[model samples]
Target: MSAKNRDNKNRWRNITVGFRVSPEENELINRAVALSGLPKQEYCYRRCLNQDVVVQGNPRVYKALKTEFATVLAELKRIEAGKGVDDELLSVIELISIILGGLKGEDANGE
Candidate 1:
């Protein structure tokens, strides 16, 4: 048998939770997870609990940000070509802005 899982508070985490989402939602969640530099489970747990998902700067997160910037650039070019902006793209931009803002704040505080 595998070892039991416990949360930071030492609470046993045995219950399983499951949900379904559309492809668009899945893509958004995956992007957020990647950008947060946290495991998918931790990200979802924090989000569900309405707790802050603090992002720590690391190679994985930096790579995710770079890839996301490329996606945003392509989307902006499409918009310039007369295509309307999609909600998913806007959501991604908002997430990126939040992450960057937090990082900026950290830098200002020399953390």
Candidate 2:
């Protein structure tokens, strides 16, 4: 067998998911991950590993939701530019997350 095949057989079999996107989308995704202070692949891997994440959704709808989330986060920053996390704001964030988490499909359950 090939060295590549031997290596593949020895490694853990993580399921693969692929994407097809234009260069612009790739750049945007890279920027987003960088802004989060994580390497691009690490960001993707952590997101994939996190069972609490909403596993499946309509891509466009998910993108729209994420866009709106960024907008809300920006609004919070403007409101508290030099301040730390406010208790009320943190609670709101948690509530929003819980609502969003409910929108996911079930394949991710108990992961």
Candidate 3:
């Protein structure tokens, strides 16, 4: 698809912008977002806007955790810029969520 065509489908288009990074940074960025399995543009857009693309949160804890995740995810954004987290962090987050009675390996919204 053309860049212009793709742009039409991006619901967050109002907030997203694109730019190029160095080849080394590009390689790293691609690798990171691949791990999270979210598209790079979407991930970058959310990070730039400081919003959670995945709105999984416990209503009771969500406001807090989502904020925390947004922050952490933002840090992850800096580390990888919409790429993804280390497996260790992913495991830890999931384990904590499961232990806290959230369904492991699934959307918090039950999707």
Candidate number achieving the greatest TM-score relative to the actual structure: 1
Best-performing candidate as measured by lDDT: 1
TM-score of each: 0.91, 0.29, 0.35
Instruction: Please write out the lDDT profile of model 1 over residues 1-111, one tens digit for every residue.
Output: 557799999999888889999998898999999999999999999999999899998999999999999999999999999999989898999899889988787553447
Residue 89 displacement (Å), model 3? 15
**Candidate order (TM-score):** 1, 3, 2
Provide the overall lDDT of each model, using Cα atoms, as 2-decimal numbers. Answer: 0.93, 0.53, 0.53
1-111: candidate 3 lDDT, tens digit per residue: 333433545543343356979996675555444433457776676667797645334453444445446655666667675565666556545634543354244556654
Candidate 1 residue spans exceeding 4 A from truth: 106-111
Of 1 and 3, the candidate ahead on TM-score is 1
Candidate 3 residue pairs that clash: 32-83, 33-83, 77-81
